[model samples]
Target chain A: MPSDALPDDPLPSWHDGRTKRAILDFIARVTKQGGPDYAPPAERIAVFDNDGTLWAEKPVYFQAQFALDEIARKAKENPALARQEPYRSVLAKDLKALTADNHKGLLQTLAVTHANMTTEEFASRVQDWLKTARHPVTKRPYTEMVYQPQLELLALLGKTGFRTFIVSGGGVEFMRVFADKVYGVPPERVVGSSDVVTFRMGKDGKPELYKTAKVEFVDDGPGKPVGINRFIGRRPILAFGNSDGDLQMLQYVTGGAGPRLGLLVHHTDGAREWAYDRKSPVGKLDKALDEAGARGWTVVDMKQDWKEVFPPAP
Target chain B: MPSDALPDDPLPSWHDGRTKRAILDFIARVTKQGGPDYAPPAERIAVFDNDGTLWAEKPVYFQAQFALDEIARKAKENPALARQEPYRSVLAKDLKALTADNHKGLLQTLAVTHANMTTEEFASRVQDWLKTARHPVTKRPYTEMVYQPQLELLALLGKTGFRTFIVSGGGVEFMRVFADKVYGVPPERVVGSSDVVTFRMGKDGKPELYKTAKVEFVDDGPGKPVGINRFIGRRPILAFGNSDGDLQMLQYVTGGAGPRLGLLVHHTDGAREWAYDRKSPVGKLDKALDEAGARGWTVVDMKQDWKEVFPPAP
Candidate 1:
């Protein structure tokens, strides 16, 4: 079948709604060769913000949870270390105290958890974490908490020759571990916040890239377009996100010449999933929400637009 | 046809010799299903350095020549600018004087030419330049000077399920302008030195990323492995290069825990192409040459390993 031809009910989980219609129409127009809005396969680039857009980001980001877990594991291994500032606070379950002073303690927790390991070792740890870690609220494996509609959308885009990429504020190495299996996006296609890594000959005489404590690049807010330009080297025609962090990415994608889409997956299903936005500390959606409305960008009300949330437990 | 199956004389321009044989053998081993060395398509990555490996890099590195030409063009547009230090030297054709003070003038030439422009505008300029720029010696269009044998090899690798990428010390945007058309590698797959880009809303209300003067990253020597890690995310199973700039990349690729091949293109054809290695100012192949020999990596003697150099003129 031609790539432009859609499979029957491709996004079955998405309900018949304005947002869904907009997405389908945009895909159809872009894929229709010789049409005025036609974009060639190379130009059919679509970027999706990971955390709250593709999966649940409630309680906290999955990556942050992973870091906290890593800290706990380390503290368990070395008991005396738990008596330290961040570790003591973490062990005492004092979230307020740990995040005080501009989240200094939390930043320290992230630093120790995220850096000072070989790239290979870091990847292995991420893989191992994903294998067993469960979402705090959902109690499902973090990967399993991914939205069914978003997964279907990703598949549909892939089938239509759109190179779907995860442009997230999440750690690139963390997301890369499961991006392929969960979203069908390869590691190279996953652009995110990253730490500076130095290359050196390991003790084993093999080349090893050690992740340093310094932040190299951050794919958040204004950094999104910069990251896209540096990594993808293409301005995506379609961009999807759930927060103010993705505002620049959506604007960058849609601002380019030709037909484009800028979508926001507004979390509005409090019962089915977390629905806090704007006021929510995690995945805040305020300025972007206003901009989306002003610009006629699709704003997906999670409860109204989606017939289903997470897929059935495997 | 299955990706593992090779066409008749897939690398037609490659002469039947040790380098070619090694390349073919490595590809076969990596592609053969159920074989111990077989790597899945996702794992079958091949990275090639641009300047001296895929194309000629003398009488000077092509990118440097491009910078010089850009400087001349700017000087021509604004005749008053010709009186300036770098511009004065460039306009007078005194390359030695311009590069006398630790390459201060040459660096300035690159800075003015390569940065402070929108990425779109920069891309357009590069496109315009490549359309007309000719090598000083051969006088052929720059893109047309790419090696036919290497081109054939890239095609062969793609056919054999390898995702080919260009990892160059050249500017990322500059290489990306011609990489797709000249080497079959996409823009995103081209990793190289880059200037930091700032994202902002343009006066036209569209998002624009402006290239800054500061060097964000340099993809040479040790920087090569870091570039590979950041951009490709996978340890390439096959790596090819022609200079010491690619030494760490070759080491990083071959050092991975897998069946791998690190190949170097030695400029041994002074008759067909300029041959000045080890002591050559441009694309010096001293340390990498020694390392390649010691590691038993395949080293292509350009005169012996290929039947053709550049493709026929259009």
Candidate 2:
């Protein structure tokens, strides 16, 4: 009898370690036709968390950076607006004051910066920001800070018939502008935090979706599973994340009745990337890290499992 | 140069008429590569209204019937519950009383029946209901009452690079139970009215989504566009419906920046199917019927355009 042909190493950036081997073995099992663990193409669903998992989320989340940039731009246009509490704190780079009162100031700032525009206008603004925004620490385009090893893994999964989705806590419209270009995930496949979008006829008689200040859903922590069910309407067979925000999502995916894999990206390389997980204000991983061990989840050590982080400085 | 070959007619149940011709022409233009009106596979989206467009919705919306059936079953299980106001009206088969006062009684009935269960439990109930439920008048399984012509159109659209979706006012979970088996549309592709679903760890230490009475989103009228944006994140090129509930969706689709088609199924056959439009209590087609003429939407006269309504007796 002929044996199944093995494909070439698809994850070149992934070092040959236990973490990489587990992912490869799981993919092979799910994609092998007529095998006990094989999942059909439609059922081969894989969900990924954004921010720290797929890209670097140091200093703050990139979405927070976008919100801050919007505030700065607004202040530059109207200096008087800068005198407001949140704006003043934002302009002064006061992360402490902005995140004070359980992020009340931050929420106010986001509401002012992100809403009251047509979705088209919001999408255009996001596109423009992506074109010019650079990471404060790395000084590289934020889109370029994505993990190369994750990209290879994503490609391998896609080749093996997995439909990849980004289930992020980032704003849905904000991630949609870059998801397709940066991660090969379409806008519809990006589920995330969202504000109310009201529909009405525009002045030109065309239907327009207006973004409102109302925070409709926050897709983080336990909300991840809610977002998945609301949007995807199916349980994912595999899930990957970097923080406690994804704890429920991992639990939901791995708990499903089938072959499943729950993986986490442990930010362990301080030199190559920021490495505060359990203590980090943004992308904290304490509870999820503990659960990963108890649940036998594949935890990737950034310094060991990955030979490269961001794609070679292109 | 050899001309682009035309595919065989995919809508056999659709009689040769203006309505059918318009559909064929629209499909040809969108699928013709290098043509002026050509759309890529990813951009070739087509949305259909569920209740009156794809299936028969004469006596009442099928979902309403499902709710009524549940009420009847519950009353049978516990006779004292039938003494309740809405339950009394429902058990008496008094739609007039149930629909009076802006459907207050009907709403109460639906709220009680649709909520307070795990999503898995609700889905199982819907599946069981579908297995035994029959149309009040047709005496056929509710699923079998789907229009044969519309099914052919859906198939044609799928074959011609269009990703079809059901944007209905029916409960999303209910539609999803049989969407794949009946409509060939996957669960995720079915977007509709939804209630709030809360997530938590179940008794078995697994994640479970609980359906609540709180309504989250209503995919009707203006909400249709909002639902499209939330789920599809793209403007469809074609939309099909039978009533005013789908007016906004048609406007949104036809108003897109490319070749578009907006079609309405007119229930004009009194013998083969119940005919009600302007003054009907259910699936009212008044406003949309008036707009169809002004907007150049293809209006299918059910008696003339379709050689067959329901699929041939199985």
Candidate 3:
């Protein structure tokens, strides 16, 4: 029995819309061999921005929530933490206080909660958190909150021989914990903002890698392209992103000399997901939204473009 | 009609020796399904050092030659460069001057030649140089001088579903230009020392990644394990290297709690390839050589194991 539908349709979770049409068309044109726009499998590199694009980043980033919880937990044991600058702001649940002055307070908060441990220890902590961490509002495990459309897109691209990577402003260790299980992106393909790690032999004559408080590289806005170039060593043929943080990455990917895709996930669904942008600090989408039309980038409106927000809980 | 020899033998360029036997044995044990030694395809990460391990580094690193040529080219237009600190030493052909105080002089030289360009500009520069640069001794193109035995081994590992990556102390962009063609390792899989890069839109309002003069990550010796951790994010099951620069990487790979293979390529063929170890500043294989036996690592004597050195000149 012949089916009417095409097997090549990769993003089943996405509604039939202009954005979905553009995505499928682009994939088809580039992957057609012996055709004008054919790019071999080696050149089919796709990079994705995490946070808002892959999973939800509504009230705050998932990593930020982890840090907030850590501060709250630590302050319960140490009363003096309530008196500290960053810890005090965090304990007061002051989101605005943390975002003031270009996120300096937020950086300080991250330093307190994330650093000062060995790389292995930090990884273990993140893994443990992922096994149980729940979203603030949704009450679902953070991993379960990943966009169904995006996951379908990732699986589709992988099936078509595209190598997908997660390039985000989140902590590398934090993201690596769930990247493979949720996104099918391995630890190596996941590049993110990171702490300075030093290599040394422990007192027991075994090697050790320690994560220092100092930030080594921040994979955000301008840092996105830098991270892609330094780590991947290739210009991405496709990039999917959201917010002002992904502006440079969109331009970097679409501006390259080939058939490319630059997608901006616009959060317009107020019921299924939060829809604040420009005014909100978390995943702000001002300049990128304004420039999307001019750049010829496809904007996926969460309300109109995605049929579902999160997948059914397993 | 068929040959009696096993078609599974992938190292035809390599003569039968303890090193070859151990390599085959390790691959067999790890890849046998449902066995105690079985490692999934994703876990079979193999890292190989460039320079002495992949190609001849006797005269100097291919990159060092590029810098020398760049210095000479610039000095031709401006004679004053001949009197500059590093330039004067380079002009004097002094190896001791370059390696003195842990290669401070060499770092300065690299800073002058390799930095302050856009990432695209640097890649273009490397690609252009690769097209014309010839080896100082063989007078062959540098790409033509890669070891055939190592190349065959890389292909074999790829066939067995082992992901091969070139992790070298050489410049990331510089090695990436030729890694695909020479070693069959794709650009994304090549990890190396790098200069800092920043992303910004150019005057044309298009994104551009600029390579700064500042040294960011150094992937050598102690830096090797850090590089592996940052880039690959998995302890390699197989590691092949030649110099002491790969010492920490060897320990990092073999020290992991699993079946692993660490092989050192000893340059014993002085006639076919220049042989210098303890006293040679370039690719010094000292402490690693001393510890190879204690760690039960395979040491391939080039004179005995390699039936042929460089591939036939094109």
**For model 1, how big is the iRMS in angstroms?**
0.7
Interface RMSD, every prediction, one decimal place = 0.7, 0.9, 1.0
For every prediction, compared with the true complex, DockQ reads 0.84, 0.77, 0.76
lDDT (Cα, tens digit) per residue for candidate 3, span A1-314: 01133364567788897889999888888888877888899999999999999999867788878888778877888988899879899888787998899998898888878888778888887777777778879899889989999999998888777999999999888898789989999989999998888888777687878788998889998899889998899998999998999998998999988798899998988999988778878999999999899989999999999988899989
Runs of candidate 1 exceeding 4 Å displacement: A1-6, A95-97, A100-102, B1-6, B93-97, B100-102
Candidate 2 CA-lDDT value: 0.89
Clashes of each: 0, 0, 0
Candidate 2 has a TM-score of: 0.95
**Candidate 1 per-residue C-alpha lDDT over B191-277 given as tens digits, one digit per residue, 9 for 90 to 100:** 999999999888888889999889999999999999988987889999999989899999999988879899999999999998879
lDDT of 3 by residue, B1-314 (tens): 01243364678888987778898888888888887899998899999999899998868788888888877766777999889868888888887998899998887788777887787887887787788888877889999989999988998788777999999999999999989988889998999999888887788877788888788889999899899889888778999999999999898898888799999999888899987887888989999999899998899999999998999877
Per-residue error for A173 in candidate 3, Å, reads 1.3
Error (Å) of candidate 3 at residue A68 is 2.1
* Each candidate: RMSD: 1.7, 2.4, 3.3
Expressed as tens digits, the lDDT of each residue in A1-314 for candidate 1 is 26446667889999997888899899889887889999999998999999999989878888888988988888989988988978888878888997789988888888788898998899998988888888877788999999999999999998888899899999988888899999999989999999999999999888899998899999999999999999989899999999999999988888888998999999999889978888999999999999997777999999999999999999
**Candidate 1 positional error at A217, Å:** 0.5
